[model samples]
Target: MEKKRILITGAAGFLGSHLCDRFLAEGMYVIGMDNLITGDLKNIEHLRSSEYFEFIHHDITKYVDISGTLDFILHFASPASPIDYLKIPIQTLKVGALGTHNLLGLAKDKEARILVASTSEVYGDPLVHPQTEEYYGNVSPVGPRGVYDEAKRFMESITMAYHRFHGVDTRIARIFNTYGPRMRLNDGRVIPAFIGQALRGEDLTVFGDGSQTRSFCFVNDQIEGIYKLLMSTYHEPVNIGNPTEISIKDFAEEIIKLTGTDQKIVYKPLPTDDPLQRRPDITKAREVLEWEPKTSRTEGMKITYDYFKNLPEAELYKKEHRDFRSHTKG
Candidate 1:
């Protein structure tokens, strides 16, 4: 059988790179596109010499020209981290809205199946305990974090519109907190923040008295969930994340144990719109795709720590730690 031809946006990112590796391992010919806005080439550099893998340096929001029938299109672009999107708010909104629309058009033209990497942030500060796909989010459009939140919500809307209007096969994976190797240490997310600080012997800053809760799925399980979703018949958005929730304070303690560092855990002022708690109801995912995260936090943290431990001494300790946490509490 001919290998499937897959194109992944944000292919150099943490999730995207891992997805590329997964697809390539499955004997698929993969085309990776990125403008390197938030992604580093080093992430995908290992595949530079692979005959089945091609990396394109371009923005997905811009026009994309390619040949061959595209078997799959995974749109994972956009600035995900608070530090990244906040620095380029306009780009974040544009990629989610315009970039996703463009890729949906590509899927229609090629009759390819496509998946958009949506985020738990779309649920805003959750009013429900564990947010299911049916819950419409409580978003603050005018807030500082609105750029990413509202943008992702718009991405999902456009994706569904394509599925409805153009008869395109689309899947939206509302990804939750995914952590593992290749996570940019300066992304301002809590996991990397705590790890980076502890590795460097700095304090672990916990925002808002450390009461906010989140579920972190290992990258391997997340990539598996996304791949299953892309290949399955299910078309609606599905929540892809671990259901086990942990408070920020407890998460810090876990990091302390994993790294075995005596870093001080400090309380800090919370940012606006941070969610009190967020976990995925993956019942739909399990029933439909038979997918559930297998890597527990303890094991995933060890893998991530091992990866970061190998980082160069300079990159390992030179990040300018910021004071504010992301408002998208999920």
Candidate 2:
């Protein structure tokens, strides 16, 4: 039997690298592409030896060309972290808009199914609690976070247009907070930020009195939900995340305990437009894909902490987590 060929953009980032591994294990020929803007090649370095995997050093915001048959395309390219998007807002917007448009065109050309990675940020400090797919969201297009939120919103709109007008097969995953190995230690996300502080014996920084809550899904569980969504026939957006919610203050405490650090919790002003609550109503995902997160926070955190704990000394101290020397595309 011939292997199914799939192309995954942002192929060197945390989630994209994992997806590449999953499809290859299923006997698919995987072509991995990334601009390395926020993605680290080190995450996908292990796949280099695999005969079924090929890495393309290219930015998806430009013309995307994949030779031969592409059975599927997973559009995972984007600068996901606030630190990243804030620093490079134009690139973030371009990837979500232009990059998505190009890939949707490719999917149309190939007659292949495409799944674009969307985010819970579409909810935009959501007016609705435990956001559902039906909520239209309360996003501000001009806010600082608006660059990313609106970009993803635009991505979703364009995706559905392509699906409806162009007859291209499409799926959108409204991914929530997910954490695990290969995450940049210095990324502005709460998980890595807290873990990095704990590891360095610094106080955990809590924004906005720490009353804000977020739901975190383990990476393995997240990838499972995404894969199931891609294979399913659903055409609408599906939430892929653990609905279990935790307050930032309490989550900071959890990290201190897990890292065996005696660090204190320090409070800071919340960034503009930061969401106060983020939890997915996964009723659609449960019904459509029959998927729910299976990894417990305790089990998942330990595994994640150990991964960060064992990192080389230099990695722990680097102000910037990404190293782009080798993978930068001219």
Candidate 3:
């Protein structure tokens, strides 16, 4: 019997690298694609020796060409961190819009199931609490973060259009905040930022009085939910995340405790359009995909801390800036 084949974009990034591992573990041939714009090759370096894995150094916003039977395509490309998208907003927009279009077209030609990685940001300082699939988001298209929010919103719109019009098999995973190993220590998300600061013996910076809340899902559980959604027969979007919510202030305290650091919490003004609350209502996922996150924050954070703590001393103090000039296009 021939093994299944999968193409995962952003394959060198945190979640994409993990997805590659998961698919290969299922005995599938995997093609990992990335442009190294925001993705680090180090994340996928360990898989280089596996015959089942192959890495492509290409950006997905341009055309995508894959050989032979492509059974599945998980579109995980794009700069997910706020620090990244804020710097390369245009590139972020292109990957979510043009990149998604190209992949959907490829899926159409190859007759493969495609799962596009959407995000909880689509909720956009959501008016609805515990965001449900039915709530139309309160996004500001012209805001600073709108580059990412609108891009994903457009990605979802076009994905559904393809599904309804061209009969392409599609799955949209509206992923919430997820963290674990291989996460860049300076991605500007709360979890890694707090952990990184704790590791560096610096004060944990809490924005907006540290009152805004975010629920985090462990990477393993996030990957499981995504895998289940891709295999299921459902066509619409599904919320995949842990509903365990925490405030920034409290979460900062937890991080300090986890790292055994005596760092104090410092407050700063929150960024514009930052969501005051975020929690996914996974009723659809539970009912349809039979999925719910199993890892507790305590368990997941310890594993993540261990991973980061073991990194080279230089990584702990690394800045968040990157040069996107080589990858950016006009």
Candidate 4:
């Protein structure tokens, strides 16, 4: 029997690297792609020697060229963190818009199933809590974070256009906040930020009175939902995340307990356009893909904390700002 061939963009990033592991476990020939912009090579370096794994060190937004047939394409490439997207705003927009288009084109040529990784940010300080797929969203097209949000919005739009007009098979996963091992300590998301602070004996910084809420999914749970979505026939977007939401202040407290640190929680003004609340309504996911998150926060956090704790001392203090002067067109 022939093994399925799969191409995963952003294959060196946190979630992307995990997806590569999942697919390879299923006996697929995996091709990993990344520009090393926000992704660290160490994430996928262990897979380099695998006979079934191949890597392409190229940016998807420029032009994508693969020689053989691909059974599936997972478009997970983008500067996913606020710290990253903010530093490379234009590149973030390009990857979501142009990078998605390029992958969609490749999927069409190969007649392959393609899934583009969408985000909860499309809800945009959502007027509707526990967001569902039917919501048209309340995103600001010109906000400071608009580059990433709008670009993903455009990604979903063009993807559907290809499906509807060009007869291409497409899937969209509207992912919520997810964290686990391999996450950069300086990614600036709440989990890593809080964990990093607790580890360094610094105060956990909470923005906007520490009242803003977010729901987090452990990486394994999230990847399971995504894998099920790829195998299912449902074509519309589906939400994949844990429904148990937590406030920034409370979450910081949990981190302090988990890390055994006496760090205090400190408040700061929230960044502009930061969502006041985020939670996903996974009714469609449950009914269609029959999926829900399985990892408990206590269980997941311990695993994630241990991964970061064992890292080199230098990584804990590293900052992730990218220099765009050397940025490629992708």
Model 1 spans with C-alpha error above 4 angstroms: 320-330
What is the Å distance of residue 214 in model 3 from its true position?
0.5
Worst 10 residues of 4 by lDDT: 321-330
The TM-scores of all predictions, comma-separated, are 0.96, 0.97, 0.99, 0.98
Residue runs of model 2 more than 4 Å from their true location after superposition: 321-330
Expressed as tens digits, the lDDT of each residue in 1-330 for candidate 1 is: 888999999999999999999999989999999988788899999999999999999877778877987999999998888878887777788888878888998999999999999999999998987999999988999998999999999999989888999899999999999999999987899888898899889999999999889999999999999989988998899999999999999999999988888888999889898888989999999999999999978899989999888988888766645322332232
Candidate 1 lDDT score relative to the true structure = 0.90
Query: Which candidate leads in lDDT?
Result: 3
Which lDDT tens digits does candidate 2 get at residues 1-330? 989999999999999999999999889999999988888889999999999999999988889999999999999999899988887778888888999999999999999999999999999998999999999999999999999999999999999999999999999999999999999999889999998888888999999999999999999999999999999999999999999999999999999988888999988899899999999999999999999999999999999999999999888878974444433232
- Report the C-alpha lDDT of model 3 over 1-330, residue by residue, as the tens digit: 999999999999999999999999999999999998888999999999999999999988889999999999999998999999988989999999999999999999999999999999999999999999998899999999999999999999999999999999999999999999999998888888888888888999999988899999999999999999999999998999999999989999999888899999998898999999999999999999999999999999999999999999988887866787766666
- Backbone clash count, each prediction separately: 1, 0, 0, 0
Q: Write the per-residue lDDT of candidate 4 for residues 1-330, one digit (tens) a residue.
A: 999999999999999999999999999999999999988899998899999999999989888999988999999999888888877888888898889999999999999999999999999999998899999888888988999999999999999999999899999999999999999899888899998998899999999998889999999999999999999999999999999999988999999999998988888999999999899999999999999999999999999999999999898988765677566343
lDDT (C-alpha, whole model) for all candidates:
0.90, 0.93, 0.94, 0.93
The Cα error of candidate 3 at residue 215, in Å, is: 0.3
RMSD of 4: 1.1
lDDT, candidate 1, at 234: 89
Better of 2 and 4 by TM-score: 4
> Best to worst by TM-score, what's the order?
3, 4, 2, 1
3 versus 4: better lDDT goes to = 3
